[model samples]
Target: MNEVQARQAIVDAGTVLYKQGYVVSNDGNISVRISPDTIVVTPTGVSKGDMNPDMMVVMNLDGNVISKGLRGPSSEVKMHLRVYRENPDVTAVVHAHPIYATSFAIAGVPLDKPILSEAMLQVGVVPVAHYAKPGTTDVPDSIAPFVKDYAAVMLSNHGVLTWGSDLEQALARMEVVENYAKVTLVVNQIGSERGLSQDQVDGLAGIRQNMGLSPIVMPKGNAEVINGTDVIPQGN
Candidate 1:
């Protein structure tokens, strides 16, 4: 997409995230790679729901501003930049604090259960990065290990980050993360979980490959029955 299209896409994505309650007042960020070196990103301190195309900031891979918007670039731009730098194929980045997903992040649990077949295919396993201060270099460092293998990762005690070949895929992955987290929470409350078998997971992996998505590792065991109190607490 060109600069104008990228800017509009970011604005549209922000509206979706806001309407879906994935973000609140100035609580999330979005970015789109317009070219190899140019990126259009949401500005900081602005409600995602209230963004316009002209409010998008244009910046280079080095984080140098090509055009300043009405406000500054998102404070977490470094984290978004880290994703693009780590995965050359990623053209869009989304970072948001969806309730269920952020709860999992807060509980220090990785969304690794293979119980949801569609989630396994679309979102893969969302691992948790070690806790790092937000909007800092350390935040980028914490997510580095999982960036190459995963489309999404939960920021420990923070939120969720997703990236894909384009803005639509990236946003879809973010939604999947929250959906998976909600189902997983329900399973925990149900006190029994039936994760997909190794063969089943392998089958899904093959399907994902056919769909041109990167392969993800799934748990290789049978169903699990959790009788303990490992459920994440109910809160954002």
Candidate 2:
């Protein structure tokens, strides 16, 4: 996408994410890799929902400000840069405070168990990275280990970061993570999660490999888990 389109797309994504309740106030940022070295990112301290095209920022892979404006690069830019550095396939990164997913992250809970077919099939297990201070090396470093395995991550006590070859898939993964977290929360309350058997899980993995899919890890459990059975009854 050209610079005009890139900035416009960022503005549009901000509106969409905010509308989805995935971002609040100035709580999230999105970036699109325009090339191997150039990235188009959202500015810090601006309400993503209300962002205009002119508010966007452009930087190099090293986070150097290639262009400046009224807005500044996000403090979380390093974390976004780290993902691009590790995953050459990733072209877009959406980091937001998605409510359900962020709730789990803030609680220091890891979404490590698989209970959905599409989730395991699409993005895989959304690991919970260790808590790190926002806008610091620690945040990106905590996530670096999982960056190669998962397209999306639940940052402990922070928020969600989802990426893909493009923006749609990345944003879709974030939606999936939030949906998965919502279901998992309900199931955990009931005290049980009876997932699919080992053989079935392997089958899913086999299918993934056969399709030549990128390596995305499941939560070391079943593949196609039973629905209500996995939905543990509350207070059980």
Candidate 3:
């Protein structure tokens, strides 16, 4: 896409994330890769819901400002840059603090259950990276391990990040992550939850493969499976 289109996409995604309550105030950041070396990102300190195309900042893969606009690039742009550098297939990134998902992150939980088949097929398991101070190199370093293999991940004690081949796909992944978190929370509230059987989960894994999706793998066995039950903890 052209710079104009990329900027517009960032603006639109900001609005969607804001309207859907995934972000409040300037809590989230959006970016789209315009070329191997160029990216357009949302600016800092602006309400995403009120962004315009002109407010977007253009930067290089190294996070250097290429086109200075009315504002600076989001402080978290380093995370986005690291993602693009690690995964050439990814063209867009969306970062948000959607409540349910952020809650899981804060509690050091991974959304890895085979409970929802659709989520399993599309988003796979959402892993949690260890906490790193946000808006710093630590944030990028924390997420680097999961970038190449996982489409989405929760930042421990922080928020969530999702990326895809384009802006729309990235945005959709964010929605899926938030929805998965919400459903998991509801199941926890009921005090009883049953995950898909091993066979059923295998079936969905086959479907995910058929759709050319990446397999979900939790690092360090962070996901706890007991007696055929995938345990999603209710954080205190």
Candidate 4:
């Protein structure tokens, strides 16, 4: 997309994230790759719900500011840059503190269960990266290991970060993460939960591969069942 379209997309994504309560009080950042070398990103200190397209900042792949209005790029641009560097297929990145998903992050949990087939097909395992100081180089370092293989990850004790082939796909992955967390929470409250069997999971993986989608390799083990309750494991 051109610079104008990229800025507009960021503005629209910000609105959706704010309206859906994925972020509050300037708590999230959005970025779209305009070219291999240029990116349009959300500015710092602005309420995402109240942003205009002009407020977006343009930067190089190295995170250098190329063009911006009076405002500057988000403090967390390094994380976005790291993602772009790690995965050439990623064209957009969305970071948000959606309630349910952030809850799992705070608890150091990984949304790795094969509980939802659609989620499995789309996002695979949402691992939790180790805790890192946000808005610093540490943030990118923490997420580096998972960036190449996973579409989304829980920022331990922080929030959710998702990347995709486009802005819409990235945002949709963020939504899926939150929805998965909500469903998992409800399932836990309702007592026992049974994940899809390994055979079923393998079948779904095969279907995903056939559809030209990435496959999620679930760890080899039975679902975590504790005293008739299903427990999702915490990330190391």
Candidate 5:
């Protein structure tokens, strides 16, 4: 992609994620693959709502800084860099802490349940990685195994990781994660946490695979829906 295009993609991602309530303040980071070894990512400590194209940082796959200005690389650049190295098919990555999805992480529960047909189709069963210190090797390594198969994984005791062939596709997947979590949360609150039927869930998976969306395996058996309320058990 052209430099202008790459830069705008990051800027646009910030605005969209922020507006969608997927990310608040400057809690998330976004990046696009500019080259095989170079990734253009948002800088640290910047509010997503007003991030400018010029503030994004360009870094190598090793997380080495190639460019720096008013904005510095995000402290979590390592998380983004490791993804680029391990998943060649991924062209963009988004890290966000939307409350609903993040609720699973904070609860120390893996989102392995396939409650939503659309989630199965769109994201499959989101896995939970073991807890690791943020901005460290632990977090990336935790997500490595599922990167090839699952487009999104919940960071244990942390947040969420979602990626795609491009920034828009990546961001769209994140939106699904956010919306699904929101719906799931709300459903749980009213004392109804029942997931879809096995046949219905499978149907959505089939549709997703045919549509070229992420291929996620629909977990068999009944799912315990946690609506928008806290899905994770107490003291998790």
Candidate 6:
């Protein structure tokens, strides 16, 4: 997308994230790579819902400001830059604090179960990165291991981070993470959480590969058979 289009898209996406209750106050960040060397990002300290196209900041891949907006870039811009550095194909990055997904992050859990087909296709397993103080270089360092392999990662005690080839896809993946978290929460509350069988998960992986997606690294030994009766209730 051109610079004008990229700026407007960022505003639209920020509005969507706010309206969906994925972010509150000034709690999230969104960015789009407008060129190999530059990105358009949400300004810090503004409610995402209140953002306008003019509020978007432009910065280089090196995190240097190309043009200041109505305000400065988000403090978490380094994490976005890290994703771009790790994977050139990622043109957009979204970070948000959706309740369910953030709850999992706070609890140090990973959304790795292959229970929902759409979740599997859209996001696969969302692993948790090590806890790092928000807005620190540690945030980028924490996620470095998973950026190249996964579309999304849960920041410990923070929120979800998702990336894709474009803003729409990145935003969609964020929604999927929250939805999957909701389902996983309900399953745990119900005392029965049966995952898709190994064959079923493998089939979906095949479909993912056929669609030109990268391989999902499932947790070691997570492919074991899990019948409904075999699950132990995880009390909230």
Clashes of each: 0, 2, 0, 0, 8, 0
lDDT (10s digit) by residue, model 3, range 122-171: 68889999989877799999999989888899999889999998999899
Which pairs in model 3 have colliding backbones? none
- Cα deviation at 193, candidate 2, in Å, is 3.5
Highest-scoring model, lDDT: 6
Winner by TM-score: 1
- lDDT at position 177, candidate 5: 77
- After superposition, the stretches of candidate 2 with alpha carbons farther than 4 Å from their true spots are 222-236
lDDT by candidate, in order shown: 0.89, 0.84, 0.87, 0.86, 0.78, 0.89
Q: Which pairs of residues collide in candidate 6? A: none
In candidate 1, residue 92 scores what lDDT?
A: 99
Residues 1-236 of candidate 6: C-alpha lDDT, one tens digit per residue: 98899999988998899999999889899999988989999989999999889888999999999899987888899999999999999999999999999999999989987788789888888999999987789999999899888889999999999999899999999999999999999998899756777877777788989999878664332466765656678779
lDDT of 2 by residue, 1-236 (tens): 77788888888888889999998788899999999998989988998888888878889998799886447788898988999999899889999998899999888887767577777777777878898987789988998997888879899878999998888788888888888898889988999767766666667777888988776886576545554554667784
lDDT of 2: 0.84
lDDT of predicted model 4: 0.86
How do the residues 111-201 of candidate 5 rate in per-residue lDDT, one tens digit apiece? Answer: 5555666666667777788889977788778888888888788887668889888888788888787777777667768875566656666
Candidate 5 TM-score, C-alpha based = 0.86
Ranking according to lDDT, highest score first: 6, 1, 3, 4, 2, 5
TM-score, one value per model: 0.92, 0.88, 0.89, 0.90, 0.86, 0.92
| Model 1 misplaced regions, further than 4 Å | 221-236
RMSD of 1: 6.7
